[model samples]
Target: MAARGGGGMTASTRLAYQYVVLRCVPRVDREEFLNVGVVVYCQSADYLEVAWEVDRDRLAALDPGLDLDQVCEALTFVEGVCAGDERGGAAGAKPPGQRFGFLKAPRSTVLQPGPVHGGVTTDPARQLDHLLSKLVT
Candidate 1:
């Protein structure tokens, strides 16, 4: 994606992006998890995106009795967080960077955020979609 800048240089403005993998832990005691979703935030471009993969087979392999509906609901909630929807709680009221920080913060729960990673992109939206396809799906 070619982004035009003031100086007529192609792709001169590279946006900064941060992202985290959302994981599901069927059993907290066992310390096991599965990558179920991703949240990507690009502040310079004012872009925030999320993507998720639903693999019942893999989930069941981890825990045959897993309540898939609950797990999916949690994943959806994570998306809501990224979108600043009503489901995001007070975190929704914050700015994009703060919201990203809230989502990327480490927590011990069924739906936990993985490590935070950074990247530079000429087009944040395209990079977001690319990451969703490569990481989530």
Candidate 2:
């Protein structure tokens, strides 16, 4: 028999999630970028979050003139959106799925998101950390 839990639901079942790698594009014209973070959205779990780390040495190598502060500020805004906080502006007020959609949309900016990818996991938070380590670090 299948295991059950609260509300008669499966106690430990895999959940579908979507994610994108956040990139620091120092030069939009040249399209050179470094993977800097990961954003994961799991509707089944009502989860949306981002994990990022700015590799100062790598970023400086990519573009010595790049503005690290501005990139970090942009990433903060993204975090706010994921948290549905005021700092994210209008996007943050949106629903979790909508916020994820906003984050995944393509844009020409210092911080850009890579293509969306999907996976299955029982825990999105752990998955985010895993992707951040594997893809960004």
Candidate 3:
């Protein structure tokens, strides 16, 4: 079957399963972009890891003086998402790193947030909803 990410498949069936993706940041020429890690991993193991590719191109476009390795490291959370392999908490928690990125790691475990990144962990709680509403839509 054709891969979702559209490339060589990962060596895991867990990746082949059907997964949902919530894309953010519309693409340049295409439709939209997948910036969140949890959504990317939960979608499929492969996706050719399109987000990584998108990120690479974006970093180059941004010209932020970032190296390829650094770019990959920043996306490590994606891998962690796969490892966690749990139903993303819904209704409440924090930003869902599953699709969104950036989370304050806890001492006992890596805290998983709800669907929308950047919350109290980021700015004053009041502004989080406003920012996410604009960003997600």
Candidate 4:
């Protein structure tokens, strides 16, 4: 459901939204992690977006020996997965929902998606920005 807001803006419909945090673990054995990015998807709106912030200072705090290059590459991959672009490879050919599912799947890697969280939103794009701001950055 939606309502008209002030300024003649129509409130967005209550649509389902899913999101996950991207974590980077320098050493998986010790299990310490840093939230580097976020992925958001709204099936109803056919929207999938990825937003990330990789602060070298924070990464170094996690592991002084951490490879900044590798981390950036991993972040790029996440963005590609969300974009479903040619860079995404085979996964890019899939639909928006499938791309989201692939990104959210559990995997042991430098860049891993945390648990998926659900919520309601009027605008998926706006919601993506909101979640990325609150959760990732």
Candidate 5:
């Protein structure tokens, strides 16, 4: 269900990645609708990188064996989900009935260019710092 990442991969890679994450990852954030997937990660430099999200309930219901390539597959799925949200579609796409119960809906991904203007450092460690400064500026 999960596949590892070290090379180029596409959307089809998610199932493999999900399997790996389900096997190794013990705890994941479970407070929101976000809990449906697994959040597998590894340490890199400083910031916590979200490697992938596995379907939590489904994975628990069924066991997926270790397949080396599966890890990269799931990461692709997470990438898809992130890309989908960034289009400004998912937030406004919510059903009308669901909107009534929640006072405020979570913000969808809006990736405007930062005040470092067109330059976001290639370094992931600088992401938080760049974003924080942009927010205040």
Candidate 6:
């Protein structure tokens, strides 16, 4: 049988996903920030994950007094939320969609999420890594 969508690929192979870039705004007042990580969620694939890397030098350039440890801690909390483990606490207990919503919600904190963007991917994990490299790194 011919595959659907004339692409010779089953729907299962092309899963829709959404992602957001996580930024660290050392000083909310100045609104200066650096891309530190990315969060990817695919409901069809039941996948949710986050990857992050901190450029200590770049972050320090934004705010000399900014605490690097605090930034790492916040990023860890986000990773925990994506994992839906105990580290996320109450937010982690919710389903993937809810967790994504909570994470994408706007906040004034140092670590904030950018606008949500969507795309199709065959492998959510691979897509997450690609986004992490393209957008965060």
Could you tell me every candidate's TM-score relative to the true structure?
Answer: 0.82, 0.91, 0.28, 0.88, 0.22, 0.90
RMSD per model, one decimal:
4.8, 5.9, 15.1, 5.5, 16.1, 6.7
Per-model lDDT: 0.75, 0.87, 0.31, 0.79, 0.28, 0.86
Predicted model with the maximum lDDT: 2
Write down the TM-score for model 3. 0.28
lDDT of 2 by residue, 63-118 (tens): 99999999989999998898888989999999999999999999999999999999
| Candidate 4: residue 68 lDDT (0-100) | 85
lDDT of 3 by residue, 50-119 (tens): 1222345654454444354643443454433433323223311333333323332322211122343321
Best by TM-score: 2
Clashing pairs in 4: none
lDDT of 1: 0.75
lDDT string, candidate 1, 2-112, tens digits: 121222324768767788888888888998888887777877667666677778888889889989888888777766666777877788777878888888888877778
lDDT (C-alpha) at residue 129 in model 4: 71
Clashing residue pairs for model 2: none
Ranking of models by TM-score: 2, 6, 4, 1, 3, 5
- Kindly list the per-residue Cα lDDT of model 4 for residues 9-116, writing each as its tens digit: 247567788999989988898898988888878777667888788888988998999998999887777677677777678897899889998999998887888999
Error of 5 at 137 (Å): 32
Model 2: CA > 4 A from native: 1-11
Clashes of 4: 0
Summarize candidate 6's per-residue lDDT along 1-137 as a digit string, tens digits.
10112123354698889999999999999989999999888887777888899999999999999999999988888877888888889999999899999999999999999999999988777788899899988
For model 6, the superposed segments whose C-alpha errors exceed 4 Å read 1-12
User: Which 10-residue window in model 1 sums to the lowest lDDT?
Assistant: 1-10
Writing each residue's lDDT as its tens digit, candidate 5 over 48-110 gives 222333444444444344332453453443433322333224532333222211212222221
Candidate 6, which ten residues in sequence have the lowest lDDT sum? 1-10
Candidate 6 collision pairs:
none
